[model samples]
Target chain A: MAKRTGQVRAITLKQVAEAAGVHASTVSRALNPATRSMVVPEVVDRVLAAANALGYRPNLLAAGLRTGRSHLIGALVPDIANTVFSPILSGASDRLASDGYSIVVADVGTNPARHLELANQLVARRIDGFILATVSRDDPVVDFCLDQHLPAVLVNRAEERRRISAVVSDDALGMQLAVDHLVELGHARIGHLAGPETISTGFLRRKGFYDALEVHGLPAGDYPCEAAAAYNREEGAKAARRLLDAAPGITAIVAANDLLALGAYDVAAERGLSVPGDLSIVGHNDMPLVDMVAPPLTTVRISHREIGRAAADLLLQQLTGGESSTRNVVLAPALIVRGSTAPPRAQSRLRNQQRGAG
Target chain B: MAKRTGQVRAITLKQVAEAAGVHASTVSRALNPATRSMVVPEVVDRVLAAANALGYRPNLLAAGLRTGRSHLIGALVPDIANTVFSPILSGASDRLASDGYSIVVADVGTNPARHLELANQLVARRIDGFILATVSRDDPVVDFCLDQHLPAVLVNRAEERRRISAVVSDDALGMQLAVDHLVELGHARIGHLAGPETISTGFLRRKGFYDALEVHGLPAGDYPCEAAAAYNREEGAKAARRLLDAAPGITAIVAANDLLALGAYDVAAERGLSVPGDLSIVGHNDMPLVDMVAPPLTTVRISHREIGRAAADLLLQQLTGGESSTRNVVLAPALIVRGSTAPPRAQSRLRNQQRGAG
Candidate 1:
């Protein structure tokens, strides 16, 4: 292969050193923020001025080799195109930027093997740490990080074992809030459109749904739950079909994700059941554009951006403090009431009948 | 400062060479796909087997230093949360991944200075090339790339000078389609919600709207156009309000972006005017969830993923072919007709009157 070279040569430290009338070693020390204190104030200012005048850009790759710190964080997400992950990435990136740490985002997709392969690639590229938003309930990538003793922080999702710091929403509280709203609206036969059980969010949210049902004095067996293979609209539609077919007379559904809930909306439309009129549905995440969907979405809103920021903070803490203790930061979720949910049609009809009798 | 280190020792090439009973240089040559041809097939097979057995991960950074190729591409986007850019990133990433290139995505936001700073940082990190989706009509970043002799490809937006390769949707054709659809529906008094003219998309789409109006035999002077300061929903809302207020008889609007069109939707809601009943709105980009929005958006569908893939291809061509010729790949856009547009109320009334007389 031919040697790859830029047409215009980059201004180097030697050039800055010569211009500043200082040794190359002194120039390097003065330029680095961490080592600037070792140099005299006047010399540092002179070096800075010379570097600025020359338009000298430091090669961070060489600096990384010398210091053994890349200042690059690798963020692995399941799907970059998903609306739910976007705000999280944005939030994490903003917080990391303030700390002078650049994030390298990798969309690992849904393949478990690909996740490990990408993570290894990032490690090979010398990323200082990882912010993983793609962890499963029992992920191999989590074990790989642990075995490698790499600094990693989980975002949006967590491993079953708290081996590393994680920032996520209170999944159970979100489910409770969804169930409480449905129960108050007199929806007894509420089904669940569950996500894939392999993932942490799906597993915990499904568990939370059952737990919420018990709290509401509703029988778990009475309300059937179907788990989607993935957290996409297509999988959600298939799962919703099975759930509806198995459990007739279902008045409402609580989906583990917004995409799945949208899938349920598709199923409802296909069955000629108007949302809130025939089959009221509630979704989680309250992802972008859910509020604008037909009949809008009554969903549990997780602070995804906050989760991202918190994840970055936790990773930074690990990098700076070198503390080994694992901490789980769980943010609270709120229910966003919209046009997708209302009192069940049966209950509304009963109220009208009672009013007529009175 | 303390040296950062992973607890587990990585498998070294020396160990792999020892296991394969070959010299370290031979092992290295056998390992690199580009240099494997230098070694005999048997020796290469032995080295590969030993490396695989030892679970040895190659340090790409070290290899990059020697080869002057990181196989890493930096993609700078204006906003990570924008749904339009997500698919573009994903498509570019997927295509690049097949060629052993990993993309480092930096969300530079809307700040022009930040774009340059991030580009400089990526250059400092020795990225092989850049895929910039943040270029304005006369972007300094474009000039910076030219001055630095960096291989860069523009996506979604382009510079007027055409110094680098770009993959963009035919912005004028998109506007013509939107306007033609509305004109076919008997919309004569059409207004425009223009994006910031500083950006190429905003400028081209706005100019296209007026050009389309002229082609449809409507006077451009009669159509009031308000340009937003940004592509965001808030800016779009402000521009839409001014456009509606300035042009009282406008029955239809062509917005520069989906967010702008949604902003028009907000203004219509505030005025208690039903969509397609009191006002018709058309959006550009046909962004994610626009199809699900209440009175689903009628808009132009730019193949963003295709544009992204094409951008990656152009950048790769620059890298592998070492070509200097600038190319602009303009993909065609289709109009997505939905519930957000219809005939003017006055035109519908006239049709009713004619039917009654008949």
Candidate 2:
């Protein structure tokens, strides 16, 4: 058998399409879930039948022998356990699965070096495309994925240099919705428990809150903003305390994430203040349990599942010989008004302090 | 290449091992991650180097062609995004990864019949083993997976008839702990919101709670138990209300799962009852957000991750032919004391109810 030495007689997807009497790209699309719907069912069946008859099963290594194309797509995720990334993995996997291609994912962990090793393994596996959910400013992985001429898509993040295909919700819109919901409750002065500036979601959402105030024609002061070290609640609590201390006149706090909102809720109670009555609050991400909270926090809802599906769609496009142009898929966000926010108190300490009595 | 027909030269793992100057089993162990560490580093290095140099990449498919053993395992899960399954998937995958095996998982929806098609695909793929997490009391998949002579393992659920290779937490011990904690809190008339009896966790945990109370010499009349339709929050709320009506004097409530616990919280709020003060509540499955809730949940902390890892360990044993007989793994549960349960109200509500009746 010549050791089956990872070599095969060269055959092209184009020939399969031609044999099936379909466009070459149509065969490509038919093999992919994202574009499969665009092809007629009969045509898809014919193309798949022809491919099977030809024994054209995706042989990643043997393809490495044929056209030197591995056809393996790679997905990188920060945390697979998080609800947000579940759909992304499912979406990308499903899309790639249809096209006789498979996805290999690398976990982004507390250990950055581990991620590098995982990336190298995927590269060694000869991944021809990549989807990165943990893109940071000036990421080396991004450079490596791109330098190899591997089609790459980013989820929830964009490189500082721009021009990367990304599927991210408008953090600015998310923050604006939260701010507007609080302001509609008659909060005169609002503060923001912002996430870290290091992350795109944090940086954009914080700026979005300030921009929202200006858009709503309100005078904004620098005291209303406090950035946390990270998106987690411990950082949220620290940032919330600083926000309240710096802006004692603030009637409501809009947390960049639900965990941060929870932190603010705790700090509010520890200081002998009652939520909604003493101070109103809104959180972002609409994460689970926020609705079950004591006052049922008001927040913005982003489609986590949609984000996943879209990211996968973008990756499949690149895999199927589609344009290499960078596409930005910005999903919309909406406000969910619950019982958390209320009007400023009649004996408003914040209002009195803002009148120059502080 | 003789058309690379179905019949091809067979290279037994035995030959590969002998060629590498090692025992056949050691070669098998060297290729498997679980047993890789057991092989000395020098021997492993030699084996791997020799195998690569000889182009001795054992064809997983070719092995199935000869022995009808695909060396593939199939895992079925209810919800991939659920926090509980994350650890389980990772644990199982990590265990299988070492053995040069991959576990293919499919999401089982409301109608389990959908699993039939997915299972057929796995069979066509010639999967040698099955690891299932969503087994009901009378699962047809059980007879199917077993009849195929395919080694199968169940997690979180067990078959009613036999000792299958299953991994589950000691739910009875978990119930005892909940009951003991509530008793320590001085609750006399307690209510239990149980999960669906259609699943093993539901049926056993409910029985355990009753058995635990009996062991404590508490009369069955002192407790009112209502089984939820499902473990989800809505069913939990329904079960909680049933418990409240069945035992109006109930001072404490023990729920089967965290979602049911959250539902009980909603019912308590609706009745204008204060948690821990008027209606102490205890829950199982320390799922995410329980800690973030207004009053953190007091529940049994079962290691979802550990369960996953344990299941993986069990499957690897089967895959590597280490354990020929079927076995079940039972994990211990820890009780996490949180803010949800407190001493029965000083005013004594159950005593007051007795007095009013008198």
Candidate 3:
């Protein structure tokens, strides 16, 4: 039953023992750092030499059974193809690597059941903890982790209840910055391209949009807002089209994500309208290459890498017998004004008309 | 020695047995799918219900020790933040998931020693096989895998020896496409921004550039060429600056990557040279957002996702006891024509002069 599959078998302790003319137990003692001191120095040298010659790699899985620490962390992302998640994964993986932890990333998509199944599989491998970047407002996986007493931390998204630790950017403040920039640019009739309501970013950013409108003494109900089915370009394009058709006078739009903002760019092109000339747009999560886009995007730059590192830190705290309190680390968001946003067309026209009269 | 880490203890088999009023061995037999028939039907039902109520998860590590099938695959990438690798990972992971195999991806930068260390760590965890995207033209990790008789497959980049199966884009064909497009636009003086020669893409593409020049009856050595230290924007900028400085008559430039092309765009902007009007550019690897650059990039499009799927398929073959022969899968690349390419300034000026005379 202990036989390995496939044709390749790794060099065993017995083989090292035969080559060194020592007992198999002596080879094992020589290999283990803690037990190496008990073996005679001459025998230990011979066993190590034999093991090195044969390319005998120690089985960490077997060692983990005795130590009860696999030192492997499981990370789950909603979409691996999304540029936004990659930096976050890189940050978390880099931080964990320094601490001698290896991350096994699973692109679990948006299915909750699949998320739980993948989580269970990772748990079966005896992972130390989880750093999940795939969580909705009210997630079943969160509940599963809590029920099983597993150590897990959320990144980029948080659960409705504060049952576990999480590290996320301030969603409401991100929307506020976008809206404030648009209002200052004299955009009165502003529309919104919202994300899915099931996720925290979508739900909170939508609420924040209306909240910002109210703060500016504008009627929130007068503006048109459409929610995309998902955080993707196609869904964003669909929602953008619906918003554009529904609100013809809108001169600006604030999207919940960079992909949705790019979707708005697609819609603007389809309608033969120039960005910032006919419509000003702003995006969230200033992902890579947004600065190089035609009319570089005016976006809310959230430090995704920092968020990932913070999440890893929280998980590490729990894994290392540190603090166990449910702490939510909310990072700040900054507005990066680029070419995609400008003063409204009517205001610019009036200024030009005034200049002509002068 | 088997006590778990941290403060949380999992629901044990003995706990399930106590809840079901049965012996621990009986509970284990009832829980295992292979041995469930050995237990009475009523007792099996009781044990399952008890296990479900207690949230008892079977220890897969322990089971794997007995069966020798972990069903886990290890994958290595150079950089996760680079958008090119994301689609490949997404494709490979999606394919492997269907076969009940989960992939653990490590971003092993470009250091051969680090790559070897990470591979050895994954091997220690008893990964069934490896899918390597970090191999160079003559990679040490490739040699290590071969010496250990490990089942490993290469993706995106292949080793010079072809000791293992690999899936890569036809890099030479990609260069030919870029050069042909520029030549068709009447660009007689073309410069090249070559990638590092340590990589297969860099070496093959540079060779292909000269091959295409000869095919088109153009002198290869007459043109300027500079190789970047790495496939990054900063290095590309340094290389592009050198090429532009060395060749004043060059009207068109072909870059090995989109980032290098964008770096050329930066240099053009710095020198107040307009794209296509002063200098025409062609790039390779039509990564995300390339089409949205100020003057959308004209580049070679590699089906990275297909390359990833093919690589996974090859690894699956080796893992499942299929073909042991080494095979190379070369995917064809296509040219995506956009706004960055045009006729040379001299030819356009000559045409304008002729029109003026008419």
Best by TM-score: 1
How many steric clashes between backbone atoms does each model show? 0, 8, 0
- What tens-digit string does per-residue lDDT give for candidate 3 at B44-161? 9999999999989877676666676667788888887777888888889888888877787788987777988888888877888888888468777788788667788898877677
Candidate 1 lDDT over residue span A279-329, tens digit each: 889999988778888889999999888888898899888888887689999
DockQ of each: 0.61, 0.14, 0.53
Give all TM-scores, in the order shown: 0.93, 0.76, 0.86
Q: Write the per-residue lDDT of candidate 2 for residues B1-358, one digit (tens) a residue.
A: 3321111233467777888898878987788787899999999988887677654545444344455454556777776667677567667766665655555556564567866655655555456677888746777788776655567788987666655688889989999999999888788778889888887788898898999898889987787899999978999998898888888888898898999999998887777677877788888989877886768899999887777778878877766655757777889899999899999886655544455456
Q: Which of the two candidates, 2 or 3, achieves a greater TM-score against the reference?
A: 3
Which stretches of candidate 1 lie above 4 Å from their native place? A1-7, A347-358, B1-5, B347-358
Give me the TM-scores of chain B across the candidates. 0.92, 0.81, 0.84
- Model 2 CAPRI quality: incorrect
Residue pairs whose backbone atoms clash in candidate 2:
A31-A98, A31-A99, A88-A308, B32-B98, B32-B99, B33-B98, B33-B99, B88-B308
Query: lDDT tens digits, residues A199-312, model 3?
Result: 888988999899888889988666789999988888999999999889877889999999999999998877767788888999999988899998899999999889888988
Candidate 3 regions exceeding 4 Å error are A1-57, A221-223, A347-358, B1-58, B347-358
Return the TM-score for candidate 3, rounded to 2 decimals: 0.86
What lDDT score is found at residue A100 in candidate 2? 45
RMSD in Å for candidate 2, one decimal? 9.5
